[model samples]
Target: MNYVILAGGSGTRLWPISRNSKPKQLSQLVGDLSMIEETYHRLGKNQSVFISTNSQFAPLIKKLLPDIPAENYIIEPDKRDTGPAMAFVAAWMSLKHPNNPMILLPSDHHIRDKRTFMEVIEAAENLINSRQVLINIGIQPTFPNTSLGYLEVGEEISKEAGVHVYEFKRQKEKPDYKTAKKFLDQGNFFWNVGSFAWTPNKFIEAYKKFAPVIGDHLNELIHDLESGGDGSEAFSRMEKVSIDYAVIEKIDPRQVLTIRGDFGWADLGSWDQLFDQLADKADAEGNLVKANWHGVDTRNTLIYGPADKIITTLGVSDLVIVDSDDALLVTPMSRAKDVKKIVELLSYKKLQQHL
Candidate 1:
């Protein structure tokens, strides 16, 4: 199957490390290689792969993803969410390979169990060949996660896919803690991983049905690009929305199917999530350090600084200290998820360079 990566998040929660100029996908937040590189390698083999990102990221991605042809990069001129972003991708792919099944992935997710992940992806890809359903790869929820979206499943489709295929009942994005507990109790909800598989034509049809305005806008821009005109202005005019809101949620329930993702997955959206993902790599005091550091009486704290700079903490507990060249962050681990607000405050203060 062909692949298209939605590489357009600003990654505000990551703050100084992930900024508007360089998103999280382009940063080496987890391992030696950047997140995007890891995602490319993890795909194993595919006919072709494309990355759709904002214009600021185009040149960087070009230099970074050398194996992918420069033409494969789709640059959104303005910041629109996944609704227009993905519609644009589907439109472009339909022009090139209408019948080919395509898999869409978010570039910034962390997957520890790639074996099970690929198995689920293969099953979803296979389902699209025989069925024209809009596929959503839903991870079985490990906990009551309030920050992420949830998917409710209905009837089973088949057990042959190495997973139980299910009818997608509905989608609920970012439910409250109480509702999340109820979902877990019902035992039918899954975390919406934002990965999907569908033939290009089927996706186009769904866009036409549920999100026609976005489809038209992207089609116009694609036509402009084909005729040697830059679609910068056209793209800037497209509506800013997400696929979940515009298309996925509105689709006929009977036409949607979900494959169970039993693999280890985390968006790593917040510092706490990152901490959990790297727990095994932490020190005895439950501190994860990615810098030159000397500490005393520090417990359950994280310290990240420039590789060459020594960051020392004394008598601090449950605090996160991240030292960049221009900015230093100190916050309680309990509020790690609120780092995105710091980015917003920076913008409000006209701290453009830091953002």
Candidate 2:
């Protein structure tokens, strides 16, 4: 099986520190290593790993993950959404390594349990090897998160290596607060972690059947690949839609299967989520500090800055303070998810340096 890490996100939610030149995946947000580095090392050194990113980030990702060979870097010519991006990957893999099952993984997630993660991947691989079906790894939801998608699962179909495999009933993409709470209350719903596994040919056939426009463009991509072309023109012609809307939601529920993954999983997409991931390391006052910080009455806040700068906060609570070289962000914890609005404002003001 081929493990392809998707690393093409701009990461606007984590602004100032996460810039256009260097996104969150390249930043060392968790520990000493970058997020992409942590993700790569989590898979261990034995598996066949590949990177799926755009040309702009390809050089930086290559620098970060030097262990992966040049041929393993699948560079997308355009900045299309996941629908076209994934279909292009399927086309490339089918042309190069046909019949091999591939797993699409996020490059910037934090997984606390590596052993259990590998076990879940092994179970998914086993199921994919036995059947020609798309497999999605579902993480047990810990909270009523309206930002993430939810997967409604049915009866358990089978068990692979102690992992319970369920029938994927349907996917609800970013529901309202009430619906999210209802999903949390129900025991059958799981958070869609976006980790999927299937053979390249199977996914290509899915595209051909459901999203025929993308499937038509995929044929041009395959032909371009065979004829030593980059397929940029063919890629840009496809619509910019997510994989869920294009193929996954349109496919029959019986055609898709999901496995329950109990391993510690968290998508560090925003500052609030990152604070939650590192909450265990907080100080007595519930402050997660990464820089030289001195607080008098700061509680339940996240302080991140450069090593040279000293961040001091007094009489502040439930806040996110991030100090970069050029920009400083101070927002209440409740509004940390709206940092992307600042990025949008910067883009509108033509302030590319701050992005």
Candidate 3:
């Protein structure tokens, strides 16, 4: 199976540290390795791999993955969401590795237990017989998180899917707090981790059958590429939507399957999530610190800054303080979701430099 990673994200929730120039996936926030590098290394060195990113961070991707051939860099001219991007992958792969099953991974996610992660993907690969099915790698939820959507799982069909591969019941899209808690209590929900595996021809066929708008755009792109016409420009005008919203949720229930990923997975989209996932990075007082900080009676807080700057906290608890070279973000731990709003406010104020 060939692996492709989606590396486009408008860094918003994790601002200050993540900007338009560099999103969290490209940042070395968790370890010595940047998130993308970590993701590549987690997959074995023997597999064929590709990265799908927009024009902005293509240089950094090139610099990081020098061994990857120039042709493998699937750089789109502009940012369209995952729907168009996945369609692009299928269209490109049909021209290149036509028969290969493609495993799509999110460019930025903290996945502990790489062996278990691969075990899940490999299991998904084994079961992928046609385009009628795309196996979603679902992480068993550890908490009632309202920020993420849930996958309701049904019947298991294979030995590999002891409980891993199951009929996908329905999507519980970012449910209310009460509903989230109810899902957690129900014990059948898995967090939609955005990792999927399926063959290109089949996936593209499924797209044409389900999402005609995206399918038409994919057809146009393929036609343009073959004719040596302006394919990228045509792709740029395609509707912006996510693969999940456009196709996955809309597909016949039999078209989607779920495989259990045993790894500890978390999409570090918000400060609080970042703090929670890297629990080892925190002190006993529940404070996760990266920057120069002198704390006085601080507990359950995260303080981080760029280089050579000291951020001091006084008698504060449950807060996130980050100092980027151009911006400073300070918010309560509970309001981690509001960071995206702050990014919006910056855009509204025409503070382009800060973003």
Candidate 4:
């Protein structure tokens, strides 16, 4: 089996600390090792791992994972979404390891326990090998997280599927409070964690059924590979789309399965998320601190970054304060989701240096 780490996100939500040059995947948000390093370490032994990242970040990936072969770095010349990204990898892997199962993963996610993660991946791999089914490792829903999409299971055929294969139900964007609560109460839904596994043939079939554009491109790529040609030029012809929209939602209901992942998983997509997941938290005064803080009445706030900065917060609650040598970010926790908007505003204002 091959593990494909999809590490192309710019991490717009984690700006300043996570910049254009150094996105969240390459940052040590949770610990000393960067998220990518953690991901590489967590991957079990005796498996080939590939990283699909933007061409711009290739050098950093090399520095981080020096042992990873140059051929394993599938650098994208342009920013295509997940669907095209998957197509490219699928084609590449199909040519090299045609029958091998491929696991798709996002590089920046935080998983607290590696043991349970390994168990889940092994189970998923077994199912993939046995049935040749397209699988998604679903996170057991802990909350009515409107931020994530929910996967509803259908029936239980094998004991492995406590519930049946996952049904590609309607995809819901962030829902209002009431709707989210309803999903939580329903008890059958799991958060679409986005980790996937499938044989190369299954991937091509799904892409042809759902995303014809990518399917055609993959076919052309295959033809080019057969003619002893490089795929770069052919890959450029495709339109970028996400795997969720291009394949998962459109596939036949019974074809895809969702394996429950018991590992401690966190998306770490926003400032508040990172704050809540921090290993340490300060007192009742609401002064939440990590690695850097020296002050009084720094109430109900989150602060992280260099210790030398001497970040002193006075009378601040529900605020996110992140400091770095090159940039500083100060924003209310309530508006954390709008951090990407700030990135956009900065871009429009021609502040590339800060990005």
Q: Could you say which candidate leads in TM-score?
A: 2
Off by over 4 Å in 2: none
Rank order (by lDDT, best first): 2, 1, 3, 4
lDDT of each: 0.82, 0.90, 0.81, 0.78
Q: After aligning candidate 3 to the native by TM-score, how far in Å is the CA of 16 from where it should be?
A: 0.4
Please, what's the RMSD in Å of model 4?
Answer: 2.5
Clashing pairs in 1: none
Better of 2 and 3 by lDDT: 2
Judged by lDDT against the true structure, how good is candidate 2?
0.90
- TM-score (C-alpha, index-matched) for candidate 1: 0.95
Model 3, 1-355: lDDT tens digits are: 8899888776788888788989998887887788888888888654488988877887887787677787777776676787888888888877777767789888898888888888777777777754347788777888888877789998776658443677888877888888988988988898887787888887788778778877867778888766856378667866788888877888788878888887888788889889988878789888998877888899999887865988888899999998877778889999997898998898999998888
Candidate 4 Cα misplacement greater than 4 A, ranges: 45-47, 156-176, 225-230, 279-286
TM-score of each: 0.95, 0.97, 0.93, 0.91
- Ranked candidates, highest TM-score first: 2, 1, 3, 4
- What lDDT score goes with residue 233 in model 1? 63
Cα lDDT, model 3, residue 330? 88
* lDDT, candidate 1, 1-355, per-residue tens: 8888878777788767788888889988887878888888888744388888877787887787788887787776667788877777776777788888889999898888888878777787788887877789888777789988999999776974576789899999889999998888889999998898898788878877888667667667778867766677666776788889988889898888988877878887877788878888999998998888999989888777789888888999888788888888888999999998999898999999998
